[model samples]
Target: MISNPAKEREVRPAPPDPALDGLLTLSSAQVLVLASGGCHSGYAGDLCCCLLAAVQGALTASSYAQSHILAPGQALALYQCGEFSIQSVGEGVCMLVQLQGDLPGRLLASRLTDSAAFFPRGGAAVREAVLSLSVLEDEHALVSGTAASSYAYTMLTNLISGPSSEAVIGQGEPLSPLVEAAVGIIQEEFPFLEGLDELAERLEVSKAHLIRTFTKQTGISPGRYITHTRVEYAKLLLRGVDPSITYVAEASGFANANYFAKVFRRETGMSPSEYMEITPRKEPPKRDPFLW
Candidate 1:
């Protein structure tokens, strides 16, 4: 994990990656990891800026006039006129990309203004790009910076081009208190959650009622949500230094290696081993230049 000392948080320049070649260049960028309760605040100035993704955990991002919670796979584009702050609700990690040129104009035209626009679920391509950046190996830090810039550009473009309906939150009906509580418990305890029955028991609600309300509100069943959460966690582990399928399986809360493989394949269209093979082996950056 990225180390954060009590007095300061280190921010490292985006390491170069050949895989990110052919994308738009960025003026500046950095990746930082926040421990529980860590906070990073800054001003946007004249550049186009965004919290490209909260790669892991939950974050509370706020601007002078607005604030929103960003879960994993979510992003927020900042309005250039104000100061903004991002705080980890728990242990969190995120990337900041600042761009020059016409990108800011494009963002303003796309309706980014006083309020920061939130991208609820940055689709698969965006997810993969962000993940790749998050896991870049520190050993390859000497490579060209083109790839890293391109990847950042690609993520921003994809987010801006998405349908606006899915980009904004707070417009729809708020989730029921029961469903919200259940989601909180799932996110925090996904690695050790026993089953739907256990979750229902914790909330003092019947299993059927819990399932119906959660599915209706979130568009996915609790069991499936649990599996998805496990799979997301597993993806991070599989992409990490460890190469053992069994270790990843147990760590991700699967009952057994065999069952883990089955569920993994069903969710990702590949076995754990295959997924690892495709992920690049990179170390975390050792040097840091910025502080948060």
Candidate 2:
């Protein structure tokens, strides 16, 4: 038995519909389970092929795992004390189906990139959801249909095959549907925002690409989008007290009162004071001494 025991298992998360997911599924795999156990049992085990293809989401074992590719007519006579999973379409051993024209490493990187915004700290929510789901094993029927299906699967390939740490993303790099989907989610969450680099880091796309794609897809640059949203929000505040021109500048993200005054005049075509004056006076605003 090994001192620090390990477990062996195969995991496949596929969806039924290539339209929704599982666009380009992996090829079938004929897996043999062999174990020299210090975990499930203190005994050696024999190797066996799953008599049939069973595409499954989660396979749990209390022992370490390893598998080898096999051509037809090949077999192993070995043993394992733990469990394993297999995906096959016939009585023959399985071959993992790589996506058509898919580059595994780049595809995987694209997938992980989708969660870049919350990665290292924020991906727990998505990871948990992925871990809990089982459809990722069901719909990989090996053929992708429709242009959308092909596009989606291409992205999945990018994810399962992670990019090198220093990998450069070129126009040649495979893009994933998940990447675009993640960007959409980020925009919705922080419509009026700063710290774009942090946000881009979380989204997992390069800051440059994020900027370009967002503008191409949405017709507005990221910085402009945030500034416009912030300015819109400031208008709501302007309807209240804190009508001082300097105060409005500070509250509206102007670094200096003079700068804020300039921007406010440009955006609204009037100074903050002038805007406040145009707004009808209501009842006297209650003030706190702390505010003064």
Candidate 3:
């Protein structure tokens, strides 16, 4: 099992490297801009608390055994931060606000825990605020002085003071591209993706290699993720106008309603009919106000 890093408060000592040490402990924390498919992977050292805000494009990040994808206008509160790996899905830029004092911890805890998650639309103000910080950092060299430093510090403080209830947990490591491609195929062709052979043939990798690579990257077997996705789709159909279980099962790529029901119960902890009774029909998500 991947142990929870958030519960541990111990700080690892900083290594004896001047450049890295300065980079981590900078008064004006580093602004990293990653191109498409680029990644930043490493240990956190002494810098445990941080604010990760996406500036452009999308970012898939994994830290503390949890992974999340952040698009523009989204941000994350990361704590017990250690050995994080953030990769740009497309062209993206992110600011790493290294927490230095007790206030950072106190403010972050009020808004989020190690698992706190925020929706795409809700983090607009926060993202904009962080983007502004990056802009200031870029211009700092032009106007280097106490005044510039003070302004940056104040901005960082104002950031934590905003409404933090939107925070939510981001869990899991990022999937490698090859594994992600295989997942896409399974999700789209749930019925045809019958066994390891079919999936491996589609991916052009050996069956054993595919299974091992996919499981290692996603922390879940490919078969399990595929099964789970189908069940989730079935639930959506069940809650819709399609009331026939057989139709729902077929549409969800299941061969029979009885089999569908059994899988659904095992995965959802309830019968299909019972699930429909308790769960509300989900509406399509509204456009994120933060997205232009």
Candidate 4:
């Protein structure tokens, strides 16, 4: 759990997902569980085959002029190229599984549209399988490709056609018009703005009401949303040629570099340099690909 003095609110993280309970049973595939923040966006232009599972938190994806919000226990399968934006709602984490082998593109072609994109239930076993593969990779300090292709194919078949697709898609509770406006304001002006009191004043609402309303609808306070937006901005800058961490910090509107580093590490498990080193300068072919 983490606290934000900026809003005097405590963020009690939800229990970790148990989707990986069968990780040891997984026989094929190489997987990795990656930590991600509540807000971010990107494009995936050349991904061929991959699965994305949301073990924790809610994820909203928009592409092809359509949008889908994936609740916990849901997975999204992808097998083609397109630009997409995946945003974590509140505090969340996702898993990525790069299935080995030459996958037939049309294996998933029938269910690739927005209406058929998300698999709503039975995510735990799949998630655990990926975790098991990740453990194997970590133990060896190398990825073993032997028999991985068979395993990846099995995982995909199970996720797509193993069970009847009767799971209900999730939709967030709609925000009141005022609360929606507040969110828009924070997102638009956060880089140049600070604190929620001014925002509340501008909206003519009490700070307590503003905090309560926003948190109730989004599960995070307005102050924290601003922080997320700023941190997300820093992530984008760090991936680019910002000259130095100080420059990135300033660009993201942080008061100083040291503070920025502390918050960045806490929110995202890695420091800016470590993130830059591991994250490709160019967005990878797969963006958030791991599903149940």
Q: How high is each candidate's TM-score?
A: 0.53, 0.31, 0.38, 0.41
Tens-digit lDDT track of model 1 for 1-292? 1122122222234434433222223444455578999998877766555555565678888877888888765677775646788899988767666544344445345656574667765422244343344344334553235545545544555566533312122235787999878866665456567889999999999999999998888777888888887787677656544446775676667888899999999999999989988876433222231111
Estimate candidate 1's alpha-carbon lDDT, on a 0 to 1 scale.
Answer: 0.61
- Reference-based lDDT, residue 169, model 2: 24
Which lDDT values do the candidates have, in the order given? 0.61, 0.34, 0.54, 0.53
Model 1 TM: 0.53
**Root-mean-square deviation (CA) per prediction:** 8.7, 23.6, 17.8, 16.2
In the range 1-292, model 2's lDDT, one tens digit per residue, is: 0011012223333333433222232232223223322111122223211211111111122223454332221212112223433322233212122222122222333322211111111111121112112123333533222322222232232223212211212244444554444333332333223446866777777888878886665555665655553354345335443344554454445566787667767778997678778864322212232132
Worst 10 residues of 4 by lDDT: 1-10
Better of 1 and 2 by TM-score: 1
Q: Where is model 2 more than 4 Å wrong at Cα?
A: 1-195, 282-292
* lDDT value for model 2: 0.34
Model 1, which residues run further than 4 Å from truth? 1-23, 26-38, 52-74, 87-95, 104-108, 122-130, 161-175, 184-220, 226-292
For model 3, residues 1-292, the per-residue Cα lDDT tens digits are 1111112111112232232222122233444678789897745444355556664557887888578888654667566567788898976666554444333344345666454444343232333233333344444533222322233233334455433211211146666778867765664345435666878887889988888998787667777777775675565456542256766676566768898889999998999899878865432112232123
TM-score of 3: 0.38
**Order of the predicted models by TM-score, top scorer first:** 1, 4, 3, 2
Which is superior by TM-score, 3 or 4?
4
| lDDT of the structure predicted as candidate 3 | 0.54
